[model samples]
Target: MKPVIRLATAFSILATGCAFGAEQHVVCPARLEPDAVQPNRPPSGWQLHMLRPVYLTEGGMLHGPPAESAFLVPDGGTSRKVGKQSGETQHWSFDVPHGYTKWMYCGYGGGGATLKLFRQVAEGATECTLSSQSADGVIKEVVEFVCK
Candidate 1:
């Protein structure tokens, strides 16, 4: 009888575990737009990173900077540079861990800038674009994320 009782308990526990695993999780957004004022955050189990080949636009011309400094600033966390310089563009790699409220992009050596925030909504990686403008010694940084 004791052995039977033990087996029953084990089965019950297994059933409960399965039920928990089957529960539906929150879905991520399809795409996120750029927001100069506010930061953006991703859903659980999703990772955030700055995509490579950062581009710069000036006077209606688009080009990559020889050496630019970019950072990933998380809310209430230390900021980190994207990556080392490589050729024309920066190496560009920084991951924002899940569950940190929100994050924003900050870049140096720009006149003025704007920011665009995007939230990822899929399992795979999303390619986002950040555009900034220089004005009045103010640098605005913008980031956009496109969901796959």
Candidate 2:
């Protein structure tokens, strides 16, 4: 059963105190190499030197996890991995480094984090989606806007 909290109560609580890192969940999705055999966590590839992390509004069934989290969590946290595909439209990609093939992807929400992906399509080709959900069921679509 869903816990019931009065609107007034919520307002009172939020108004009373605001916690740091509460909105720091929305994060860049991870990516793995095409031939990678490992699962869980970001493949050794998903790397961003300047993520410029920001927080956006997260929408969910009210039962969703916090924004910047994950959509379908396995153990905890958000990550990704993938296999080689014929087409290049896949939302996932990677950069090979350290002699090991590492995959890479730019997503608005948590993408390519699943051991096996269901949807690998993104909105933009070169640009990462500005709005995406997390594995924890958190919605961080409005992160950029919120930060702005």
Candidate 3:
């Protein structure tokens, strides 16, 4: 009788889809535009680093500067597929470093673009879309550092 009850309980748990597994959630950060004037010019001890346009592929890596405080990632930030692929273009996702609540993305080739920040709940990782519009076929990285 005890065995039967245990089996029923297990079945019920499985039916409810309560299986233990890592679930990912998106953490939205404060997005900033290129022309947006932030009152806090010099955010504490942080500095601005201008990254040249880096041609990226589907699985390529967009390396951030290795400084005292880099919101983006210095290395190991892999590109991920987001939406459907059109022509020879593909959308990629670059995970930002944790603890960074603010970021700015400026596109040179494109007219204007938006920066979307996302955080992985399972791994607690923060990331953003590299570029939504690549008119000249290049995406630039703009990073503003701030003392956390």
lDDT of each: 0.24, 0.24, 0.26
Q: TM-scores across all candidates? A: 0.19, 0.17, 0.21
* Candidate 2 segments exceeding 4 Å error: 1-22, 34-148
What's the lDDT for residue 146 in model 3?
Answer: 13
| Model 1 lDDT, full chain set | 0.24
lDDT of 1 by residue, 7-116 (tens): 12111111111132331112111122222112235456664443432222211111122123223322121223333311111111234255322222322223442222
Candidate 1 wrong stretches, greater than 4 Å: 1-118, 137-148
lDDT of 3 by residue, 1-148 (tens): 0001111211111111112542222211122233222233445677543233222211111334212223433333233333432222122244545543332222122333212221112223233232232223332222211111
lDDT of 1 at 79: 26
Top-lDDT structure, candidate number? 3
How does model 2 fare in lDDT? 0.24
Q: Which of the two, 2 or 3, has more TM-score? A: 3
The TM-score obtained by model 1 is 0.19
Rank order (by TM-score, best first):
3, 1, 2
